[model samples]
Target: MFRNVEIALASLYVTTTGVLIAGIYYVHQILGVEQWGIIAFLSLIMTLVVGGILAKIAITPLREHFHHLERFSKETLHELNLPINTITANVQMLRKSHTDEKSLKRLERIEIAAEMLKERYNELDYMIKKQSEREKIEHFDLREVIEERLVFLRSLYPSVTWDVMIASYVVNCDRIGLGKVIDNLIENGVKYSPKNPIITITLQDNTVSIKDQGIGMDEITLMHIYDRYYQSDSTMAGYGIGLNLVKRYCDRYGIALHISSRINEGTCVKLEFKKKGIVDG
Candidate 1:
């Protein structure tokens, strides 16, 4: 889309250049006033014709490239679902069958890996489907969703202890989308924190905060944190798309998202929910 805009602007520049040249020639060389009007009209027509042709030539290839990329991404995401589901199901079955401690622990690791893969897949799916499908927005209890996600995540990150202080906050938005945002924030806190780290989660005044005493990022990292596929530390096991997706969801729902951090201190992510209404009446 940006490339197309550049092409259009270039075409306009070409038209202006042509018009300027013709106008200069008419003023300096041509003496007949009647011919001047005729020449100016002819120049305008010629400029439009040339500009239109050049814009078409410049934009067609770029449009085709983006279309091809979109198709490839959709096809790849479609192919991934079958294998991810298979791995997840098999891991669950194995966990149920294995009673031994070491075996169960190994199985748990596999389950966590499978779950992470599934989440990345879902994010990709959301990016593609959200453009076409109308969002299933409705009022849902924020506290309920937060607790539900914590239940699923707690076992996965056994070392990190969560401190949650939530009041009855109701939000009108897509529940699943909001859950993803919450999941990503908590996951990041756990992933970067030290052994048995404390994660503070608070929800009040229509705002949710996730704070971690982990390896906090620098200013440069914070600046590019929301960019797609931009990871601050390449050593960390993340594709760097999670926070970007969170930003998109927040923008769509009028949620104000903010992050504050300093190296070796900590990081705090605050999400202020926009009001549609309150539920705890």
Candidate 2:
């Protein structure tokens, strides 16, 4: 799509610029006053045509970008599918073989991670068709998920405050999507917040909230919170896919995803969970 636009714009620029210069020369030396007005109008039209050509040229890089991302998405899907199955099956095998306490515990975490990867692969497969029958849902421990992601988030945002409540929120959710949503929220809060500012994460009754006392959002950002590539602040590190995943999980599990923020103050993200309720709920 962008490639076509680029080509069209580039063609327009060449045609318009050529015409405008010729028209001005004709109006100044060859044409009289009456004809000059017509020539000038033609020149103006020529400029617009030239602008279109430039737009086409500018769209070349965009076309390449779109192609790269699309191809990457397809290639990665093929690569990730096999690994997901292998890991999930291996995890199940380990779980059965492990009878000791530590072995059982380690296998449990591996099983959870494997389960998440399976859902992620399924999401990739269902992305285009959006097959409702292949939906991935399960009861997830929010604390475990948060802890798993904390190691990564700490690396991403070292200065921001890190807080996680010592409780379990076994909410009915899609493990992969839920983990991605929460990870995105926490990372967003950490990235946008002022250094050393308090980032609070609290859980109660299956509701988990991540609040940050950092650069707050205004009406515009708040309105399009989950919009793709919406990085109004320029400082935050994401293309807005984070909150989008959050929204996805929210829709999948019938949970509430709320956001409130103010400039120079901070933002609060609330993830409402279904209390052991099924996905159909």
Candidate number achieving the greatest lDDT relative to the actual structure: 1
The sequence of per-residue lDDT tens digits that candidate 1 reaches over residues 79-154 is 9989988998898788778889999888888888888788779777776667647567778889999998898788
Clashing pairs in 1: none
Weakest ten-residue segment in model 2 by summed lDDT: 126-135
CA shift at 147, candidate 1, in angstroms? 3.2
TM-score of each prediction: 0.71, 0.53
Segments of candidate 1 deviating more than 4 angstroms: 1-42, 95-97, 130-139, 174-177, 215-252, 260-265, 276-281
Computed on alpha carbons, the lDDT of every model, listed in order, comes to 0.83, 0.72
Superposition TM-score, candidate 2 onto the true structure = 0.53
Off by over 4 Å in 2: 1-133, 276-281
RMSD of 1: 5.3
